[model samples]
Target: MASPLITLRENTIWENKHGTVSITPRSLCDVWNTWVGPGVSNGPIWRPGLAGLRALVAQAEAQNQRIRGLGGAWSLSPAAATHGIMVNTKPLNYIELGFRDASLDTAFSGNPDALCFAQCGASVLELYQYLEVRGYTLPTSGASNGQTIAGAVSTGTHGSAHSIGSMQDYILGLHMVIDGGRHCWIERASKPVVSPSFCQAIGAELLRDDALFNAAVVSFGSFGLMHAVLFEAEPLFLLEKSLVRMDYARVQAALGTLDVEALDLSGGRELPFHFEVVVNPYRVSRGQRGAYVRYMYKRPYRPTQASAGGSTWVQGDDVMTMLGTVTGWTPHLVPVLLEPILSAQLAPVQGVAGTPGFQFGAADLRGYVMSSEIGVALADAPNAIDAVIDVANRFHWSGFPAIRYVKGSDATLAFTNFSPTACTIELPSAGSPRTLEAFHRVWDELRARGIRFTMHWGQMMRENREWIEYGHGARVEEWLAARQSLLGATGQRAFGSDWLTACGLG
Candidate 1:
């Protein structure tokens, strides 16, 4: 059989969407698409594509070069970059929508029909369209659909779904190409999904260990090349959204308490499927309309309802990009200038509804943006916000602060691992030096107040052992051990990146 097409572009420079992180790698390896022919019974349909990925790893190993799997390139951090060859996984976009009953383990209890086998390069938008047509939907996704499945899961991408956890939570299994072209299928031992035969069909060894599975799920390509992922999907559903401005005092109590009754919305009494709050730190005074509150209530999937449409003001890239550009011209005027711009852009919109796919549709490329996401326990949200506001007061902040709540994740390195629930305070701003300076101060202030927090892997962070240990503590050691066991010393060297090494994970 002919090998799948793989292209090599030498001396290439890789930059992310926000232009925050860039890498000039030795070469860029593009893993082009290869059609999968019909398989006999349970044979793997993705043999050609899988072999191509394995070859890329083998080649990297032969040259003693590090490899980093590149996806949507949506991350602001260098988590997806490497000093050696960067494999462009975009063409590895094959997806199998549902699992067969014959492919299931005898002990598996979940519905096989709801599972999806997606290649690492399959963008989240692709999965959204594929599943919606089949009357299914992902439980939760980041605010936008630009990120690939592997990229999103590796970095523990999240949305404001208070009930459901981050993207990694739905993943059932991992198909990885580790050192020396070897491949394996990893799943939780306590809750097996695919049978051993299924692993054999895919030419992968089956390892059902919870610790290994948790570590691999959110390791950001450090566990080796995540060729594909098996994730659980739910019956399709719609969301009724309401984004409006409210008095700062009215929503202040709900910021930390999460008391559903605090701020009046259409989805009253019952808990919302998604809840978020965006505040202008400079404008928060009693009786002033300084907070933008958004609530998305779950609704049954109805064929008659229009397909998901344009995104609400949930994401901050567009607004932040503009702020960043303007701040370049008037660095000192940011304190006086950003208030109206924020107030207008963050204006209220009532009774807008759509599917998760439509509501969180493709995001626009906002250049020169910087975002730092800090995850704290839901109970400490108010104090965290207070600290951020305090910093904004002292510094000329060029951006606004948005608060989102997500259920804690089981993935070992997931930032939202705060028990019960996590409140992620996202500081999206321009890439201005002044704003960047203030961003670091936010971290220092949080620590000074004795607030426990974790930083998002995909966003900006203080790249140091101290910050990582402070947030993750013993979990960092557990993750390092898992990586050490699975990849060994050789595999770790091949997959390790400068970002990981700087953070002391390497």
Candidate 2:
């Protein structure tokens, strides 16, 4: 018998940096670089591809190893899995999208699979760019464009808009590989039917049940390998990015009083496209316990260079300033330099920046993360700062990253889009042991508060049952079913029941 091939390293999806891990992977799946669990630690594999994956899956099956898939690695909960063969689908990052003539929904009536097909590894940024270039757009996406398509939808990512559903809403279907076997195509029964040949085209059984579709679309990698995806896209347009930075008091004042009813707005101090808050942990000692709110305004998509006399917008290069690899330098030195960098970045757009068309964060985040990030939902945006402050008080999250908000949904996989407005707190920190404790403590505190929240499916987070019950509940069951149905021929398990067992779901 031949020994299996393995890539070993202590890696992190945070800064897209390679680090050490406890176990070695036979193959990779759809996880972010910052992913961590039993079979994985630190982050996603450097670069994962199709052949590497098939060989890995074969090896795992032959060796009786459990197989699981991950994306974004954002879920702080254990849903991504702790052990076995974890596949990171990032290297499959090919995105070629072309939507059906128009809003397929109007023609099909809320059925998913109304548009183009995306390779499982495509990032939200990649998809957004594809659509923007073609004059199409996705319904919603997380603030940062780093998450992979599989990770975003599997974890039930969402965007703001009282009328739209979460990422699941736009998913017409996906190409998935199951633990028991190979890949398959999935869609809601009501949606347009895909050919059996198409299903077989990708080594999967065709499943089109509503319950199954609903469950699997946000399966959190428990179902199986998400190889490809098909989703609807809207006509391309621009969001003026009515950006606003607000104080903590104003948001709280409006919360109970409905004063801050609108999470995204332009100037009227409302209707923002992108909304976020930045928490300063140590600053609390200086009478700062809350976060700063920043929101965006939606505008038309008109391409023009800022230097060419158009409005200027910050790109990934600008945000990259947030993570400078000038290591060994005094800590203060980096932030000091960054302050001016960010300050200048905030300046109005001057050069013509073309990202597909109308959009923000055009940079692909498949491997984007300065460090590990933990996302939490806050009962009150104003009060949410304490969690970060707690971590900061402990000296974790040394370099703070801004917190972003997106109107959540009722979907099982969404992080914040719920009936009540929730604040998504993202604690960005270096993947150092010193800060891990602080991250855990802050996460535990938030969980104890009975706040109805979920962690990013792409990043590290707690995995207790309580998080699962509130995170997605029976939805996980449905997700499992969807996986089983899709992998009908192959009786397998990706990430095994670790996600379920950890959550006491099984």
Candidate 3:
């Protein structure tokens, strides 16, 4: 059999909006591979398949070179960058459906009908399209569908479903290529999935351990190269959405408890499938108050004419990108100029129904945006919001703060580890120096007040090791220990980046 095609580029300059990385060499490969094909080398060779991927890891080990996986490059932080070799995984998009007794372990009780095996490079949109064709859909996804599955899960990307947690929460297993060319398939010991044959077919050694699994789920590429992931998707469903403008008090009440009755939503008193609140800090006065709220309720999936909804869904990128442009032109007049934009953009309160993919369409800000998101306990939401609002008012921040809630995530390193639920305070704006400075000040104040909070790994944040320890506490220690035990010193060096070292995770 022939080895999979692989390409190497030298002295490449890879850059995103927030950071730039100069790679000495970069490797790109496809996802097709035949393990027993012709010209099999004594040592591993660089290819897209499991064997080829392991070969790259072996080469990195042999050369004492660091390796990092590059996906959609959607992160606002430099967590994915490295001075050493970069492996481009975008070409390795592949998706597979699992069946009952697919794992070598017969005791596996996972619902094979819900299982989806997605290669690391598959974009969120690709997965959604694939599942939609099979009469299934992801339970939750971020506001956008452009991120790679591995990148989103690794960074703990989340949606605003108050009942559902972040992306990592749905993942059941991981296929990782660790140091020394070891390929391991990991799943939680408490809830095992896949049979031994499944592991063998993928050329992986099965290991069932909860701690190790949780650590790797949101390891941010420190654990190893996440070649693929096995997640439990759900039957296709539609979401009925409504956008309304409410006062600060009403919005605060809903954020604190997610009580549908208190907010008086049009969809009766039941809890919503998804909820989010956007607040304009400058218009907080009673008469001028403005809070744009979105509520989505789940509906049973039904095959309908494609023209029923008439493509009413709109991508968030157009609005956000326009906001970026407007803020860039007149940063000083943001408070005076932003009120009408918010009112005009969020005035519609009618019901519109669509699939999860259509509801949360591709949100690409086109590299003109900067954001900072912090997660706090649901009960502490009001205080956190007030604190942030106070700072924004004082500094005249250009960006408005939005609040979205999600059930706590099970990933060990997830920022939304708060019990019950977490309220995410997200501030997005054009990449302005003043906005960035104000965001830092908010972080400082939150820390000084001892307000329990955790920062999103994929967003702009203060890279302070002490703050990480303070926020995550013992969980950070456990995550670090898991990394050390699994990756050891060699794997650490190979996957470590300056950002990881700064966070004390390297």
Candidate 4:
């Protein structure tokens, strides 16, 4: 049966807001419109929504064409772009919270109320609003709440939560459409969430394997089309945010060692829910206010609590606004243009409190901005920052570096795979050829300095198989082995893309 939810247009040019990735596909397919609630529906509205996605996969296979799923189009890399068929999944926004007693496995031990089943297209902001009203919330999300749930998790999106892991860490299950349009409900064998009855009712085969689950959770869309995800949500809480400016020398000690006392926040030795440091590369000398520090402490939820309003520094989705205005790379002009903006935006704000949704809210796409994130061991962060600063200054790059720490993830392909904790340094700069050249140089310089690092899959970086292997080591082979075991030869080729091939993952 032909699903009415699927629409295909020929010869469409798909371009992202950042202009970093542009693709003119043979066909652009929009996969969904109306949200089909649970239960088998014989109606024209497409009772079983997976039928459309499955049909798209079969079409791609039969025609011998590559197909890729497009989410919020938030990725700076060409990860989602394909020359054959591009499916826009933004309309697949559907949220189902809580599970039925019969639908859950008897072995399931976690709270069912904390479980959320969200379609691939559902944005992070939507989930935030949906859960907040029901007295629930996600444990963590990226700095900005713009990317779709599937895209964010698959790419290993993270924020400054050293205690908590990346967004993918909370995921318990994945509903995916694999090779030849075969749909399956995948979860960890050791930690089963849904029962076989649930899978049967949803018209999916049940497969509980930890290796497959971990690989698919952060596989960057190579596994197949992610129809939906089941993630563990937490009780609603507030974040008390404080932003302050300090000299580079003052915070150097705390960079490698995450001693909360050294940060000098109101909480003293108590660790923060979120911690990040933004540095102006041009002004890293002693006594200079080059570091802008932000810390958010967890607070009990209160209905009477005043909103903190939306004012955050460079962290997640949005680019550096100051660098976006610069047309060319001019070292002299960069400091002159940056200092005033930094001074105004980096001023201290204390005792402001809000929910995760309010603190990290909507962000507009900046086309002129480009970002490259590198993850290294927590203890190696100070040295990494120094390396980046040197490269930025020498290259005359018109941007700054922001440091964030996250607990290492168990996901096989996660960039934040460093043991204990991973410190991620994000460089957001003007989108220029010279800036890209500088990024390539940074990768080389880091390698030369023997600083082992991994690049974010969704962000801008020089793609090299050797670099990927250097960063991930044996995890790459483990991920590939999992893919081979799950998808087999046919599905691997169907889901493979140029980007995946470039990184040696395909």
Best by TM-score: 1
| Tens-digit lDDT string for candidate 3 (291-408) | 8888889999877432111333353322444465565467677667778877766667667777887776765344356788899999988888888888978888667777889999
- Candidate 1: global Cα-lDDT? 0.84
Per-model TM-score on C-alpha atoms = 0.95, 0.70, 0.92, 0.94
CA RMSD per model (angstroms): 2.7, 8.3, 3.3, 2.9
Model 1 TM-score, 2 decimals: 0.95
The reply for model 4, stretches above 4 Å from the true place, is 33-48, 304-322, 325-332
Ranking by TM-score: 1, 4, 3, 2
- Supply candidate 4's per-residue lDDT for 96: 77
Which candidate would rank higher by lDDT, 1 or 3? 1
Residues 306-381, model 2: lDDT tens digits: 2111212344222423443332244434433543443343433322233322344533222122333433443454
Please, what is the whole-model Cα lDDT of each candidate in the order they appear?
0.84, 0.51, 0.77, 0.83
After best superposition, candidate 2 residue 333: deviation in angstroms?
A: 9.2
lDDT of 1 by residue, 1-506 (tens): 35666788888777888888877999898886553344423325566667778998898888999999989998878898998989988888888876787899988887788889999988988888888888988899988788899999999999989888999998999999998889999999988999888887778989899999998999988999999999888899988777878777888888887787857788676768988888888889976788888778889887745453344335432344456555556666666776677766666677666788877776666446788889999889989999999998887677678899989889999999988999999898877777789889999999999999999999888889889899888999999999988887778999998999999989
The CA lDDT at 423 in model 4 is 95
List, in order, the clash count of every candidate structure. Answer: 1, 77, 10, 0
The parts of candidate 1 lying over 4 Å away from their true place are: 35-45, 308-334
